[model samples]
Target: MKRILILIMALVGLTVMMSGCSSQETVDVTADKIILVGTQNDYPPFAYADENNELTGYDIEVVKEIDKRLDGYTFEFVATPWDSMFLALESNKIQAIADQVAKTTEREERYLFTDESYFAAETVIVVKSGRTDIQTIEDLEGKNVGALAGDSYTLLLEEHNTKVDNDIILKYSESGNPAEILQDVQNGRVDAYVNDPIMINEVIGKLGLDLEVVGQALVNDDMGIVFKKDTQGEELKGLIDPILKQLKEDGTLVELSKKWTGGEYIPE
Candidate 1:
């Protein structure tokens, strides 16, 4: 009888040790966990610095909301230039990007995009006020056009130029400055510029620039958070996708779009 009692006590102690080990492992995994999100601070109404120099914008707020819903995970924003944003992501400096990144075929092959899109935009041509002569892609022939280097707008212009037998003078801007591009158009340096219509309107209003959007929207794009194509990225996407769908269904995404763009830009 004494031997039986000793074996039972030994089993109880072994079970307690195993339980302690499992609890410690869980705690170690969750402790100090954080998600690094990248964004461009210059992109207003989407992601930008406010008067207090703190990062606050539509994208910034949306990420904050996600962080709140996710337990044991924190999101830290890393402001970067648009040109270098992808480089930073590829290097694992950031876990994801919340900038208004459009999902394109070429980019899809390299990165994993979230299943839910946070915003949508239409590309438009911007010219100096009173320049109604140039209104469409056909009018850009034999004219100087400017666009940010490595952007979809630049790709569209290049494709159009080729279709027209290279009649357009493409001025690729590497500075990533919307104001500089607008100034070039105002000074007659470039005949026109191309970018997202929502962004163009916000920049013109915020800076009080004398520019007007002309021509119909050239392309429609949906924007989503971007992640690296890897195991870690896949895990993060799995965690956020369901939450994003819930937000969309509950009308939170539409509310954010209206607050930032002054209209319901979220697609049905």
Candidate 2:
């Protein structure tokens, strides 16, 4: 009886040891889902918080489709401040940024980009609707220009037209997003604000804001996803490429853009 009891105890210990080992070795690559963060809540059509406070918009839908492609992986949405979105990525607080981060030489130095451009837009000066006096890009030369500090647009405004020797001093107002910039412009707090043309149109249409695009879109740019400044860049590249390609091929991107933006912001 002693021998039999000892044998049973030994078998139970073996089973427990094997079970623990198996559990430890279980690699859950799929369960290790990627986190996509954004700060364009007020930039609408790209990203924004609806009345319900849910993050919903063009960029939100695009990232959701990207999530669908990675069957094993899931996505968690976090609303990050615009200025801190990249910082969040750098700190690994978020795995990726799905905001309407435009491609820029300065940004390229610190980040990797996905090939797919959800939309092509240009920078434009937004002013109150009746302001015909500020009719062109030239009109903005000496005027106080407003843009979010530390944003891609600010860099574009600073570096693009260096030919002019300090023609306009960008009055970096530290607004949270483009909409706030427009609100300041309308309220006469700022002379003018710069932002994506599509976004300006969307905000005007949605809120019926008395804002108009005063000049032609400047600084042509492709909107895309951004990843950390690391060799693991290809991880996001590999995951999103196949999915975005499929979406483009099936006209899904256009459809989604329309659904979110009320029009084909991603023009055919």
Candidate 3:
């Protein structure tokens, strides 16, 4: 009767209120509150811990810029190991990965690549300064080259390793991380180390290692932010592409590179 009708209407009102609150929560999920994932705190110049142990580096800076471009947003960082970084992104542990990920056709299939290329880089051969024996790319043939496992350098070496000849062994350093592989080269356990030129200089600057970019650079690469392969990234990609292009045009990226690596980082 009339009492029953009144109770039903009251219940409907409560339901409507709950729905409104849910919608408000959705509206709050704009870019400001987005989360990012990156490697462990020691990937210096890209992502690392500062003297105060706060997470800081180039990737953090560029992601902050991206947050600025996406009005009403903030950044939340998730520190993951290099091996687990991709999986963390895959599992939605973070909204995106701003860890200087390079675009590859294979990864493109598994992830959504931002049209924005935040930094341009290439692999380089590093050895002692006085090593005139390894002068060019060709000279790396039959030499003991080492790099971190699961790094982009490994992929590059895999491609070019065979080109040198099947006789030359593409030795993989048994180290768990990049620093160890670089150390192997410095300690004379390996003839050379192949890594990103920017990263090499940055690490060397930090450790005061006497190394030089010995051979010609390998594989030119464009590093981009990574997101899960989904419709959500589609809209974000459209918005971020132009912002990155503007950063490059205005030399913001070059400035960031110098701050991080103390080297010229202009896109070539």
The prediction achieving the highest lDDT against the true structure is: 1
Off by over 4 Å in 2: 1-30
**Candidate 3 deviant stretches above 4 angstroms:** 1-32, 167-176, 263-268
**Count of backbone collisions within predicted model 3:** 2
Report the C-alpha lDDT of model 1 over 15-75, residue by residue, as the tens digit: 9999999999987775647889999888788888889888888889889888888887899
Q: Spell out the clash pairs found in candidate 1.
A: none
Model 2, range 1-268, lDDT digits (tens) per residue? 9999999999999999999888877853336545555556666867788999988888888888878777766777788878788889898888788888888777888888888777766777788878887866667777888867677778766764587764666776665667767777878877888887778888777667888887667677778888887766668777787787788889888898778655665633
Clashes of 1: 0
> Per-model C-alpha lDDT, please?
0.85, 0.76, 0.75
Tens digit per residue, CA lDDT, model 3, 1-268: 9999999999999999999999999988764545555556767778888999888988888777767777755667887777778878777787687776778887888888877688777878888768888866567677888755556776766767666564334566553466766777778877788778777787887787778897567778888888787776676677777877887788888888889877666555
Model 1 residue 101 distance off true place after TM-score fit, in angstroms: 0.9
Clash count, one per candidate: 0, 0, 2
Query: lDDT (0-100) at residue 29 of candidate 3?
Result: 72
Clash pairs of candidate 3? 32-73, 32-74
Q: What TM-score, to 2 decimals, does candidate 2 have?
A: 0.84
Model number with the top TM-score? 1
